[model samples]
Target: MRNFLIDSLGLAGFGAMNYGLYLKFGLADALISAGGLLLLLALAGARAAKRRNESKGAA
Candidate 1:
């Protein structure tokens, strides 16, 4: 599904970014970056879910 693909891409991007950070900086930097990214992703997903639920309720 489209959502699956998007989620897959997001995970892939996260992995790549984390690896790059680890290589350039270190494990600590990578961990921090991953945590921040996870927080952002969680917020975005929550917002999307809220919008979806509201639209369903309206209909």
Candidate 2:
């Protein structure tokens, strides 16, 4: 699962960001949107890690 996240989602995200920088040049809104996406990803990763730890204690 971790490998999937790093190999697929992470690669796609950086790929998009790289393309976004070229396509959406000089636009502050684009940067804001990128930041928002990164924030959401961070929140999701935290939630997943939390669940993993929670399940470990239950086991």
Candidate 3:
């Protein structure tokens, strides 16, 4: 399914980001990267929620 592929790609991207950050910089930088990842997830969740609400209201 399209959603499965999207989710898989997102997971891969997160894994790559974490791996690269830790490998290149170490723990401290990796923590920063984690915060950034959390922020990104929060923003994405908010966007998804908004779209769902909009769609529900339109229907």
Candidate 4:
């Protein structure tokens, strides 16, 4: 569920950035936005993975 949301967000972000590039947005701007989203996605994924591992260890 949460993992799905995180993945979706990441996908959506990429799609948006691609669209921006297609629309001729400056390279630096597009990369910055994409990089920010990637960082956010990475953090969320790491957190979710950590929680899953903890649950498995408890069980």
Give the count of colliding residue pairs in each prediction.
Answer: 0, 0, 0, 0
lDDT of 3 by residue, 1-59 (tens): 99999999988998888889999999899989888988999999999999999999999
| Order of models, best TM-score first | 1, 3, 4, 2
Per-residue alpha-carbon lDDT of candidate 4 for residues 1-59, written as tens digits (9 for 90 to 100): 99999979978878976677757977777777778877997899899999999999999
Best by lDDT: 1
Off by over 4 Å in 2: 1-9, 21-25
lDDT tens string, model 2, 1-59?
88987789877977678567758674676677677877998999999999999999999
TM-score for every candidate vs. truth?
0.84, 0.65, 0.73, 0.65
Tell me how candidate 4 scores on lDDT: 0.83
Q: Whole-model Cα lDDT per candidate?
A: 0.95, 0.81, 0.93, 0.83
Off by over 4 Å in 4: 1-13, 21-24
Clash pairs for candidate 3: none
Q: List the candidate 1 regions with Cα displacement exceeding 4 Å.
A: none
Winner on lDDT (2 vs 3): 3
In candidate 3, which residue ranges exceed 4 Å CA deviation?
Answer: none
Q: List the candidate numbers ranked by lDDT, top first.
A: 1, 3, 4, 2
**Clashing pairs in model 4?**
none
What is the Cα-based lDDT of residue 2 in candidate 1?
100
